[model samples]
Target: MIKQMPFVETDRLYLRGLEEEDVCDIYAYLSMEETREFLDLEQQQNIDQTWNLLYEEYLPYIEKSLFQCWVMEQKQSGKVIGHLRLYEEQQCLFVEMLLHPAYWKQGYMKEALMKMLQHVYTFLKHQNVYVKVRKENKNCIFLLESLGFQYITCVKEMLSNGKMYNMWIERLSEKEWRKQNEKNT
Candidate 1:
């Protein structure tokens, strides 16, 4: 099992491990049609389904420390607004993230991801990380590009929509991220 991730904080958000109380807030986004479109998750019908997903699908792996997941809480309101999950495979880390539509375009996801990337490269000592964004998810693609991730390839992925869709695989190397960090700093 991998080590549990440490808490991460940013200017306006705190990224911490998941808790049982987070189900409701997570359901809010998972049930939204807008948020579900870009994600590969099936649209949840009710809170129970969300609970099942958390307890059965996610928590087991999380408990084993196989996957590092965090709930993004707004520092001011102390509300759970989003979540991020990651796992490493064959020396490359993979990322999955979701945020409430209400928080979209506000840089909340970017803030959380930037801090997460710092942790991955600095503390976790990962050399590279990757994320897969749907072709239609322009906002996410733009965000990844802004973070110094380069397009590796495009593949047809089966999404919640039940159809194969174009997905862009983007990768960011630690060396590249450090160079960009230096420029921005």
Candidate 2:
């Protein structure tokens, strides 16, 4: 089992493990119609369903070293506002990110993503990371591209929820990461 790591701090948010107390906050955004648009869920989820997903499905992944789900909290208010996750499968790391509507356009998601990517590259030592965004989700695609991710291809049956989305993959070798940081400095 992968022991839960400590919270990661960004400029405006904190990315930490999802605790039982985060259920209400998670459900708030997840239940919203707008939030569900690009998501794979076909139907609006009820609190009970969300709870089961968190406990039965998500928690086990955390305990088994298969996934890491984080609750994004605004540092100033200490309020849980979104969720991000990195799942490891056969030496690859896949990222999933979502932010509440209220926090949109505030750069919280980008900060969280960059911090998490750094963590995976530096601490986890993963060779590559990937994220899938619905083709209609242009904003997310732009974000990923801006972060140096390359578009792989559009997948027809990529998700079980019946959404055909484009997949973007980003590979970061230790040498590449070091050069990126050095250039930034």
Candidate 3:
């Protein structure tokens, strides 16, 4: 097992490992149709179901070092706003995130993603990290581009709606991220 990740903090938020207690907070987003759109994830029917799903499916991610999920909480209100996930797959680190709709346009997800990128590169010593965003998710695409991620290709996915949509796979390399940060700082 890999070592547990240390808490990641930003100016307005704290990213820490998920606990069982976060089930309800997580369900708040996972149950929403808005949150499931770009992600194409299954919706949690209720809080009780969310708890069972997390306990059976995601709880291991917190215990195992190769995979991790951080619950993002606001520093002031102490409310759970989102989550950032990191896991090793196919010789690369895959990053994923979800945020409550109320927190949209607030820069909270941006800050969390930035912190995760640094951690995945600096702590995990990964050369590259990948994020797959639906082509329609302009916000995510813009965020990735702003962080120096380059578009790799578009993947076709057939969603539960039986409609085809394009998913863009973007990659950010450590060298590129460092270069951009150095130039800005």
Which one wins on lDDT? 1
TM-score of each: 0.93, 0.85, 0.91
How much is 54 displaced in model 2, in angstroms? 0.5
Scored by TM-score, the top model is 1
What TM-score number comes out for model 2?
0.85
Candidate 1: give the clashing pairs.
none
Deviation in angstroms for 44 in model 1?
Answer: 1.4
Candidate 3 per-residue lDDT, tens place, 37-104, comes to 78767789999988987776567864554475788988998878898777666666778888999898
Cα TM-score of candidate 3: 0.91
lDDT of each: 0.87, 0.74, 0.83
Clashes of 3: 0
In order of lDDT, best first, we have: 1, 3, 2
Higher-lDDT candidate of 1 and 2 = 1
After superposition, candidate 1 runs with Cα above 4 Å error: 62-65, 89-91
Q: Cα deviation of 119 in candidate 2 (Å)?
A: 0.7
- Sliding window of 10 residues with minimal summed lDDT for model 1: 60-69
Measured on C-alpha atoms, candidate 3 has an lDDT of 0.83
